[model samples]
Target: MRVPIYQVDAFTKRRFAGNPAAVVVLPSFPSDTVMRAVAAENNLAETAFLVQEEGQYHLRWFTPAVEVPLCGHATLATAAVVMERLSPNLGGVVFQTASGELPVARSADGYVLDFPSRPSEKVSSPPDVSKALGIMPTEVYRNQFNYLAVLDDARNVRDLQPDLVAIAGLDRSGIIVTAPGDDGYDFVSRYFAPAKGVPEDPVTGAAHCMLAPYWAERSGRSSFVAYQASRRGGEVVCRLCGDRVELEGSCVFYLEGQADISL
Candidate 1:
């Protein structure tokens, strides 16, 4: 079988700067095992697979090791592929996913992802959490998806070098370390999900689902511009609505190729 694949860098205008995701547009759904094998072979933070059904797309995301319910960067990259290649005249696309229906629209700035807001509740930091992170956060919060660690400074977020093994031991899907931005941006963050096979994500849109609400209450603002302080950094624009969050960012196309796999 021959599968068309595109590698796109999400949340950045330039290549090799943001989180790269592999997007495969399928004529029909493949078996879970084949999809998992393809994702493992891609070996990026996330690989997105989509199939059109009844005029809408059904999307799924996979890491090298596991399939996740939701993924922001990969979703953004998928939207780009749908808009640019699949349907150039399309102003927007609605995707049915494990997390639910996600919609992406083209905007003047870039692409806007309409995602559910994930507000976190205050919680005590787990002892191992600090040990894994190598530094204690000022406060801790938990949502359905990840643990949000509020640090004192953005520099701390940028400079962190966590023990991946220890992080893998923590009982959470992922960990998000964040702080107030120093520059024009509102906040900054870094994500670690060793358990899910992503040691660190360069630019995470899913983390912002929690961060948007967290910062909105703290900063008393509904809109924000955020920066992910990874080695290959990128930018995210966020806005918190009552029950949803709007994330905006651009994508850079890196490569397009065919993957040959035996059926």
Candidate 2:
């Protein structure tokens, strides 16, 4: 069998500067084993599979090692594919995912992703966390998905060189280190998730679900511009609206091809 595939760099207007996700638009849902194999073969942070159902698209994201409940960059990349290639007439698209109904709409700047807000609670930092990260966070918070670590400076967040082996042994999904941004950006963050097969992510959308609310309370603002200071940097426009967070970023196509694999 043959499967169509697309590689898209999300959260950046230019290629190779953002998180790249593999998108496969399928006529029907493939078996879990097959999807996992495809994702492993692609070896990207996330592989998004789309199947149109009842005029909406059902989307699933897989890492090389496991399936994740939520992913931001992949969803944005999928929206770009739907808008520009799959359904050119669509100005927006609703994606049914494990997280719930996610809506993506085209905006003047790029595309806006409406995601549920994930507010974290202050918690004591784990000893292993500090040992792994090499620096103790100013504050630590925990949510259902991951841990949020706050630092005093954006440089601290960017300069971190974590022990990936120790991080992979942590109990949670991952750790997000963030601090106030400079040079016009409101906040800056870096994500590490060795457990999920991503040692470090270039730009993470889902992490901002927690970040937007946290910063809103601290800075007393509802809108923000965020930067993820990874080797390949990317930016995100964030907005907090009650229980929801809006993440906006641009996507660029990297490659379009077919995967020749038999089911």
Candidate 3:
């Protein structure tokens, strides 16, 4: 079988700057083993698979190591592929995913994603957090999926060199380091999920689900321009609305091809 595949750089207008995710448009859902093997073979941070059902889509995301419940950048990448390449006239799409129903709408420039808000609760720092990140965070918070480490400044967040092994050993699947941003951005962050096969994510959209609510509470504002400070940095516009977070970003298509697989 020849499966259609596309690679897109999410959260960036230019190529190679954002997180690249491979999107496979499949006629039907494949086996878990097959999907996992495809993700491993692609070797990207995440691979998104989509199957049309009842005029909507069922989406699943996988890291090279494991399947994740939620992934923002890959979701955005899948939206791009569906709207731009597959159906140009389509204005929006809803994806039924492990996280829930995710809606993507087209904007003048790119797309806006309506994602579930993930509010983290403040907590005492874990013993290994400082050792893992090599710097003590001013505060720590925990949610169901990740640990949020608040730093004093963006420089510390940008310059951090963490012990990936220690990070992997943390209780949470991922750790997000964040601080106030300069250069007109509201906040800057970096994400590490070594246990999930992503040592450092370039531009994480899912991380901002926790970030938007936290920053809104801190600054008394509900909207923000966030930057993920990685080697290939990307920007995201976020807003908190009740129980949902609106994330906006653009995508750049990099590769389009077919994956030949034996059924």
Maximum-lDDT candidate: 3
Q: Give the clashing pairs for model 3.
A: none
- Which candidate, 2 or 3, would have the higher lDDT against the true structure? 3
Question: Model 3 — TM-score against the truth?
Answer: 0.98
Model 3 weakest 10-residue run by lDDT: 254-263
Q: Lowest-scoring 10 consecutive residues by lDDT in candidate 1? A: 254-263
Per-residue CA lDDT of model 1 for 26-99, tens digit only, reads: 88878889888898999999999989988889999999999999999999999999999889999999999988
Candidate 1 off by > 4 Å: none
**Given candidate 3, what's the lDDT at residue 173?**
97
Ranking by lDDT: 3, 2, 1
Writing each residue's lDDT as its tens digit, candidate 2 over 90-110 gives 899999999999999999988
Clashes (candidate 2): 0
Q: Ten-residue segment with the worst summed lDDT in candidate 2?
A: 254-263
Highest TM-score against the true fold, candidate? 3
**Candidate 2 wrongly placed segments (more than 4 Å):** none
Model 3: runs farther than 4 Å from truth? none
TM-score to true structure, per model: 0.98, 0.98, 0.98
lDDT of 3 by residue, 1-263 (tens): 79899999999999989999999999998888888889999999999999998788999999999999999999999999999998989999999998889999999889999999999999988879989999999999999999999999999999999999999999999999999997889999999999999999999999999999999999999999999999999999999999999999999999999997554
